[model samples]
Each structure stands twice: as C-alpha cells, then as structure tokens.
Target chain A: MGDARRALALVRKDLLTERRSKAAFNAMAFFAAMVLFIFSFALGPDAPGMAAGSGQTLLQYLWPGLLWVAIFFTGILALSRSFQVEMESGGMEALRLYPGDKKAIYAGKLAANLIILGAMELILIPVSAILYNIDLIDKLPALLGVVALGSLGFAAVGTFYAALTANLRARDVMLPVLLFPVLVPVIVAAVKATTLVVRGDLMGELWTWIRILGLIDLVLLTVCTLTFEFAIEE
Target chain B: MNHRAQAAGSDTGRRVVVEAREVSKRYARNWALKAVDLRVEGGELVSLLGPNGSGKSTLLRVLTGVTRPTYGSVELFGAPPKTSNGKRQHLGVLPPQSYLYGELTALENLNFAAVMYGLKSHDDELVEALAHVGLEQAADRQVRTFSSGMRKRLALARATLHDPELVLLDEPYGALDVEGIGWVDAFVGELREAGKTLVIATHEIGRALALCDRAVSLRGGRVVYDGPTSSYEGAVSGATDSVRMEAKR
Candidate 1:
C-alpha cells in the first residue's frame, strides 16, 4: 500500500511536469503528424493514390500497418522522455536514495508512458484516418481495444529498456536500438490485431490476435517488473 | 509510531545507526573510496571533511546503497543497507542535486514528496513545511525560477519532511547565501537539540567544525584524522604535512 502511494505520487509528478512543459508531447505530436503527411504524399505523388485491385487505395489497405508503424516510432519519444526527465533532473539518484521497492518507480514510469502514448494515439488515429480516407467510426470500439492492448505491451517493454539505457551517453540513439528488438513480438502481435480490426475480422480471428496480445502483455509486464531493479541499478 | 522514546537499537550498547566495514568502491580503474570503515552512533553529529576527490560523497552513497561497494559491507540499524523499506523508512538523504523537478511548483514538489514518503495528505503541513523554510510566499512558484538558496532550503525541507532517525547530507551548503547558510546552521542546531543523528559531508570546514562534535577528515580516499573538532585543525595539518614530507623524501 505504501508502494502504491509512491507510485501514484510519481505518476502525478510526471504527468504534471509534462503537462506544464509539453516537451515530449509537442515533439511526438509534430513527428506523428509529419509521418502521416509524408506517407500520404508518397502514396499519392503522381497518381490519385496507390490503387489496389479492389476499390481500396494503398494507404487504406496498409492503414493499420502504417498507423502502428507511426505509433511505434513516435511512441519512442514519450517512452524515452519518461526516464529522461529523471536523468536531466538528477532524480535517478534521488529515486534510488528513497527506500522503497524501486519497482514502484518502474510501475509509475510505465503508467505515465502509457498515458502519454495513449494521448498521442487519440490525436494520431483521427488524423491518419482523415488523411488515408478510412472510416474508423464503425470500428472505433474494437480498434481502440486492440490499440490499448498493443500499446500496453509496447510500453511495458519500452519503459524497462528506457531505464536500462538511461545512463548511457548515447541514450537517444541507444533507446530505439535496444527497444525495437525486444519489441518485435509485441509489435507483431499488435500490428496483426490492428490489421484484423481495420480491414475486417471476417474469418473470426480477431479474438485470437487479441488473446496473443494480452498474453504478450502479461509476459512483458511480469518480466519488466521483476527485473526492473537491475535495469535502474547504478 | 513515536520513535523518540524507542530504543535506538538492541545491539552495540550505543546503538550503531550507520556502519561500514572495509568498504571500497572503484569506478573503472580509479578507486573513489578505498577500504573505508566508519561507524556513526545514534544522536551523534559527525562532519565528513574532505577535498574535491577525497570520496566523502562516495562514502555517503555507499551507506545509502545508491551504489554498492566493490568490496566490504554496510549496515544501517543492524541490517544490510539493501534490506527492506521498513528499515529505510528511518533514513533521509540530501545529495548535491536538488532532486526536484524544475517544472513543478514548490508546493507540488513537497506534496509529491510527502505522498512518496507515505505521509497522509495534509495540505497545511506542506504549507507549514514551506513556511518553515521561508518559502511560503514562493509555494506556487516553479522551482526552476527559484534562486540556488531557495532551492537548497526547499531541498532541506524535502529531505527531513519524513522526520527520519538518520540524515545524510552531501554538500548541503554548496549554493546557499550567507542568510541561507545561517538558516542551515540554525536548522542543524535544532536537529541536534532534538537528538537526531546527522552525517554532513562538506568542504566548509569552519562552519562544520563549529556545528559538529567530531570531525572525520579524509585525504586521497583515506581517513587521515577522526577526533574531536577541538583538535581537528592542528592534528589534521600535522598528519598530512608529515605524509607530504615522506612523499618528498
């Protein structure tokens, strides 16, 4: 229970700081919007758009993959910035100095990253849907569920790796380098589920993908929490 | 919950609060702390005096378990420093950094720290803590906008907000103004009056020697002199000068 209070305090502190500064959010917003714009321009450069055999354009057919791709890429900023706050403010040593489970720190950081990534997706999804001419209104509920699951899996690992590489001199480059590899299974599960949700679950396999994503999240969350002390150790 | 009346510890008749035996820490090839041994008893105010690379901060870090010793052991309240949070709940630390978020308001910072320390939500208590540090007017101001002295005062409040049995302060007077230094002096005087054990690491030899009873001076990661402050000045100089003369020989 004491650990719970500590975790909640961290979440409040981190979110309040980000809300005031907008450092991570602004950068993520700009980069996410740019990714969507560049991909749209590339798909429709000379022709009307990348046309598939059916009435679908390449942007529509590949919307799920492109959206998750943007999310994963842009999500890196929020995840790394979470721990970067501690690094810049010298709070890492302070965090270690405090006598607690230290896992509380991991949980707090993971929660904050999840919230930041969620907020970004809230904006990115609509913008991408408008740019790509995909109707997400009908699929919003299932799509959101899948998005949440995928993001949980992604953030769980991303937060852990962020702490692991926090003290490195080349952290910005090293964050993605270390994060993306371990995230392969998570990314694959998420993209697959999002793809099923967007195009159609005509074969009734959306649940299978969702189950896989949930399982992956469970595994990642456990491993990350258990070994977190080592990741943040001096 | 009232530890003022509780026994310091059941072991070591005097209740050894902080103990380190043969602790050595190396960063890469350079040893920052070489085979250091120290024992701080309950209610004893000790000054850890040293030069730039003399390892005062390193020893404090080892005692707090911020970094582990490559060799040797450390105990706080008769248990390993890496023990449970229940044991650590009695400890407080103020390192050189403010350990504060610049974007957060002073009040918000204290509130966050209070919750992290597992204290109940008491708005008046936080404001009172701020007021105690002469920061009541700046409660809503962002910490980044604060002067170095203001930040130090706030950090001091944050460190002792939980009212721990042992406090470790590294360079606590580093960025304070004259008035701020006086504030710290008064604060430490009050802590001593209340029988709190404090280990302060600093280069302000004059002020520290005045406030503390014993001085433990370090040179080149070794304890050169550990004795009463009355004899520290002459004894430390004579010892180091002889070592310097031997090196010249």
Candidate 2:
C-alpha cells in the first residue's frame, strides 16, 4: 500500500474509534472548558488597573499566556490518551507490523491529535474571548494561523513522546515533564505571536514570531518523522 | 535462501519459508535465545513447546520481526525480516494477549486489520471470518463486552482476516475453553489443509504434539528437542512425561 493511503487508513481508524468511544473527546473538551473558566476566575471580575489610555487591561495582557497555558495542558491530556489506547491494548506492536513506511503511522497519529486539539481550540477560542472580554473577530484569522503552526509543533513532539512514554507506569505524569521542556520554543513563539496578532500588530513582531513557530514546527516534524520508527519499535 | 511458493492447496515440493541461523537475542546480562538455529518449511504447523520463560515467545518475536536478534541472522520469505513491510503484510501474528481495541466492535476490529493490509473490500471476507470464528452473532458487539474465549476467537479472526500466507501465534490457546481449544485445532487443521504455514508457541505439549506436524522444545533459551512430535518423549527422555502430563492437565 502507498504511504499516504496507509496513513489515511490509520487516521480514519483512530478518528472512528475516538468517535465511538468519545473517551478523549469528552475528557479533553471538558478539561479545556474548565481551564478557560478557571482562568476567567483567576483573572478576576474587575479589570486590573494596568496602564491608562494604553487601551489594554490586565486580562488582555494575560490573554496569550492563559490561552497557551490552556492549550498546553489540554494538548498533553489529548496526546497522552491518543497513545494510551494503543498501549493499553497492545496495538502499538500490531501497528508497527503494518506494511508501509512506518513514518505514515506517525503521520496519521500526529494528524489525529492535531484535528482533535484543533476542534477543541475552535470551541475554546470563541468562548475564551467571551470570558476574557476581548474582541478577537478582526485578528481571528492571524491568531488561528499562529495557533495552527504552534499546534503542529506541539503535536509533532507530543506524538513522539506519547509513544515513548506509553509503556511507562508513570506516563501521565511523565509526558508533561518530558514534553513541557521541549515545548519551550513553541509556547514562547506562540505566545508572542498571538499577543501581537491579538493586539492588531500583524506586520511587525507577529511575523517574526510566526516565522519562529514555522521553523520550530519544521524542525520538530522532520526529527519526529525520522525517529518514530525507533520510538515504536522494541 | 531459496524462495517458496505458498499458494493455497499446494503443500508438495516443500520449500523453506522461515530461516534462522545462529540467532541469539541478548537483553542486558541475560540471553533470551542463544545460537538457536531453526528452519520452518512452508505449510507446516510447527509447535514450539517450552516451560515459562523458555524463549518460545522470544523466538516467535524474532521470527515476526518484532525484535531483532542480538547476534545472528533471521529471515522470512528468503530475506531479513526487519526491513521489509511487504513480507510482513503476507504474515499474520497473534501474541498471547488480544490486541483488539475493546471499544471497537468485532467487525470494526477486523475492518481495521483489513484496511492496514490494504484490502479494497472486506465485507465478504469480514462476514466469512466472523462466521468462521463463530462470532457472527457478536460481530456488531463491542469487544469489551465479549468473554475471554470470544475475544480470543475475534483475535484469531482478525489475524487471519488478511489471508496471510504465514501465521505466527504465541500461546494461542491462553484464554480458550474446551470448545475454543477444539475450534483452534480445527482452525489449524484448516490452515494446514489450505497450505498455509504456522508457528504456534505453546506450553501445552500434549495438544501441540497431537496437532502439529513437528515439535521444537526450548529450555533456558536453547533448543532441547526438535523432531517429529510422536517421538518427542524419546528425544527429551524421562523429563517429557511429567511436562507432557502437566501440559495435558
């Protein structure tokens, strides 16, 4: 079979299983909403007095930080569960036995995590804007673009680590510990880019941050694709 | 490394399908398999019998390319097994535990394997496989709801759903009942009749001796006995009687 076809089949299998079980979706979606709500409370009802005539409140300043924090935690939850299914059922060995470029398996898993996280972000973005009381309609496209790139970075590394840690008894705790350090570049670039895009500065620092995200994603995707065969093998 | 033709219903003109030369798998300080040499002819039901931790599973893993032998060469279909997906596609493997997802239905589990094997249409094969395993009525039921015996049946169905030429099963009768064991014997018979090769790693020496064309016994990662199943007692001497009785029980 062609690599692309096998990748598609794997993705289809994952999505169909997720749809039927709703295990990851239910837990991830609920956790994402709770994170947003908690941030809303933590940010406080009264807008803190930051800068007069600066046209931004403390909540606005914290938007990028809080949003990425939410995504980081939620992404870990979703990615961990993605491979947990395979590990718990011993399906990883079976998947490794599939005939094709093994990279296709990694590609399929990365795409599935991206889709699940992306769908959650779609819901979280609007609700987050409402809770944070920020008007993001104008910058929505740019913000989403940055988010997509940053998410690709997250999925790339997260998918690799998820497979690495799947067999560990401490996988749930180990995943964040191993993943967060590596995700520093993505989180930094995403926060900086999202802040600028949300602040209506699309042509200056935003592009630089976007470029950084793209570069990180490119590097991580290549590295993960090259190493996933080893990660899943015995 | 000669090639073998494995078309169904043709077992004559025996040819080699699996070849292992001085295959040794070492882990840390322990050797799992030490200088083991084995060759399986096409269309043979070869049972690997051994006690706990006797390297049956390790050898099976080596043959299936799930693990690389530490110090020797192994091949399936006349080539090193590790690098070729095409050869793996023509092979089917079942470990002791079921690998099927509990959330997926019986049909869905088979469908996943069919898709992985790049089967264009499995509707008919799916039905036949399910029926062959006597899981037709439970085809739409989630695997989690099935009993252990049922799950084993479903796993067998899923493994063979792709019509693989060689089947490698490790402890295939682990969770089976009396009827399930009978079913497995019948299934192996059918496979032998169809000219498909099989390697079954099992602890049940009596059943394996009764069903397999040949038997290979391992002790402490080394082959202790390899010959016709009928003369296994003579090959291993007095120790075989106790192990065989224990296995029968």
Candidate 3:
C-alpha cells in the first residue's frame, strides 16, 4: 500500500513537472503531426487510390499504418525526452536516493510516458480519421483496446531503455539504438493487431494479436522492473 | 591489534547493530577491499577516513548489502545483512552522488523519498527536514538550479527524512561550503544526540575529528587505526610525518 502511494507520488511528480514545461508534449505532438503531413502529401490528393476507392476501404487500410506510425515515431520522440527534464534540471540522482521501491520509480516514469503518448495518439487519431476519410465511430472500443495494448508494450520497453541510456555519453543516439531492436517484435505484433481491427475484418484475428501483445507487455514489464534497479543504481 | 578483535571481545557485553567479519571485495583484477572488519554499535558515530581508493566506498557498499563481499560476512541488527528485513529497514544511505531527480522540485523529491520509506503524513516532516537543511524557501524549486551546497543539503535531507536507526553517508560534506558544512555538522550532531548511529566515509579530517565519537583510518583496505577520533588524528599525523621524513632519505 505504501509502495502504491509512493508510486502514485512519483507519477504525480512527472505529470506536474510536464504540465509546467510543456516542452516534451509539444515536441512529440508536433513531430507526429509532421510525419502525418508528409505522408499525406507524398500519397497526394490524386494518387492511385484516392480518386476511385471507397473511402471506407481506403481509410481502413491507411488508418492502421497512420496510427502506428504516429505512435511509433511519437513514442520515440517522447521516450527520448523522458529523462530530459530530470537531466536538464540536475535532479536524476536525487530521485534515486529516495527510499521508495525502485519499481515505483519505473511505474511513475511509465505512467508519464503513457499519458504523453496517449494524448498525442488522441490528437492524431482524429486528424488521421478526417485526412484519410476513415469512419472510426463504430469501432471506437476495439481501436482503443489496440491502442492501449500497443502503448503498454511501447512504454514498457521505452522506460527501461531510457534509464539504461540516461548516463551514457551519447544518450540521444543510444536510446533508439537500444530500444528499436528490442521493440521490433512488439511493433510487429501491434501493427498486425491494429490492421486487423482497422479493416473491421471481424475475422477474430484481433484476439490472437491482442493476446500476443498482452504477453509481450507482461514479459517485458517484468524483466524491466527487475532489472531497473541495476540500471539506475550508482 | 585489529579493531575487529576488540569489537568481537566487546560485542558479548553490548548490542551490536552492525558487524563485519573479514569482509573483502574484488572487482575483476583489482581488490577494492582486502580483509576489512568493522563493528558499529547503535548510537555511535564512526567516521571512516581514508585517502582516495582506500576502499572506503567499497566497504560502505558491502556493509549496506548493496554489494556482496567475495569473502567474509556482514550482519546488521543481529541478522545477516541480506536476510533480515528489519536490518535493511533500519538502514539509511546517502551515496556520494546526489540520488535525486532534478526535474522535480525540492519538496517533490523529499515527498517522493519520504513516501518510499512508508512514512504517513510527511508534509510536516518534509518541511521540517528542508528547514533543518536550510532549503525550506527553495523547496518548490527544481534541484538542477541549485548550487553545489544546496544540492548537498537536499541530499542530506533525503537521507535523514526516514529517521532510520543507522545512517551511512559517503562524503556527505564533500561539496558543502563552510556554512553548509556547519549545517551538516549540526544535523549530524542532532542525529547523534537522538541516538541514531552514523558511519560517514570522508577525507575531511577536521570535520570527522570534530563531529565523530570514533574514527577508523583505512590504508590499503585495512583499518590501521580505529579508536576515539582524537587519538586517531594524532596517529595519522605522526604516520604522515614519518612518511615525509623517510622520503628525505
């Protein structure tokens, strides 16, 4: 119970800190939007499928890619910025000295990253819906489930890599190097699961992918939680 | 001739909170601590003094259960240091580096640490700890903006916030200014007055001499002198003078 409270306090600290600065969220959201805009222009207004295809089918195909791309790139942006606030402010070591369970620290960071990525996804979802002409109202719950599962996998790996690279001399370059390799399986599973849902396939393929994602999240989270103490220790 | 022997001979009569028997640690090709032994009782402030690379930090790490000794054993609060939750719970550690988050404000850092120690209603405690370390006004400020003195004070606040029975500080006063050092001295004095045992590893001979009840001087990972702080200093000075005279030859 005390551990839970401490974890919540750590989460609250990250939220409050981000609320004050707005730098992390802004950078992530802008980067995500830029990616979407580039994709939109590259696939131009008069491109192969834009004129002849049924808007629903077009959206169903494009929505999954758009959502996952936004999330993946934006996640990288946000996770890279995970310890920036702490490092810039010179407070990373101070947090470690606290007598709380190191797990709480990991959870707190995961929570903050989830919140930032979730917010970015929320914005990207609507923008992608309109731009790609996808009708998502009927499949809201399923889409949400996919997003939640995928985000968990991202946050689980992201938090660990952030701590691992926090002290390295080339943290900016090191984070993606370490994170992308480990996250490849997660991204593949998430993309496949999201595509099935976005197409409204209803072929029951979603559950298998969801289960795989769930297992991946669970394994990564457990490993990261146990190993985080060593990564953060001085 | 060894402090370990004297401590063992003395342990039968009194309560020993921490006891290290023939503890040694080796990292790869280098031996960080070679057959070191120490015993610290409750309510005693033992200053561990040594030159750089004398294994002071390594010894503290072993004692705190953070590092396993390659040879020998350590018991804390009458139980093997690793097995006893009560022993581990009673210990407070302040490492040489600031173990804190600079992104969070001073109050947030203290609050987070206090909660981890399972303290209920730490608002007043946090405020009091900050005030004790002269960081009350800057409590809402991020630690990154703090000067070295303020950062050290914040570190001290975090270490003592839990009110643990045993406090292990590694160079706790290294970065403090004169005034900041006085503040730390007073804080340690207060903790001592309240019967909390402290083991501080530092090179500041004067501060250790003035603040500690007992001092142990380490040379090549061995305790060469362990006794009352006053006698320990004279012995160190005499040894230094001898080495200097020998150099003339």
- Going through the candidates in the order shown, the clash numbers are 0, 0, 14
Error of 3 at B52 (Å): 2.7
Candidate 2 - CAPRI tier? medium
The prediction achieving the highest lDDT against the true structure is 1
Candidate 3 lDDT over A99-216, as tens digits, reads 4467877888898899888988888888878887777798889888888989999999998988888877799899988898999879898898878876666678888999999999
Query: Per-residue lDDT for B112-180 in model 3, tens only?
Result: 777666777457778888988888999889877988888888888877777789999999888778887
Every model: iRMSD: 1.2, 1.4, 4.1
Relative to the unseen true structure, what is the C-alpha lDDT of residue B126 in candidate 1, on a scale of 0 to 100? 94
Q: After superposition, which runs of candidate 1 have C-alpha atoms over 4 Å from their true positions? A: A45-52, B1-12, B242-249
Q: Tens-digit lDDT track for model 2 on B1-249?
A: 101111122435688788888889998898889778788888888899888988999999898888899988988988888766688878988888899888888888888788777776557779788999999999899998999899888888878877889999889889788998888889888888888999999988888998898888877777767767887766666555544554465
Error of 1 at A223 (Å): 0.1
TM-score for each predicted model, relative to the true structure? 0.95, 0.92, 0.84
Clashing residue pairs in candidate 1 are none
- Judge the docking of candidate 3 as incorrect, acceptable, medium or high: acceptable
lDDT of each residue in A1-234, candidate 1, tens digit only: 989888988998999999999999999999998888888888872343344555677778778888988899999999889989999888998888777798999999999999999999999999889878889999999999999999999999999999999999999999999999999988898898898888888899999989999999999999999999999989
lDDT at B26, model 2 = 91
RMSD of 3: 4.0
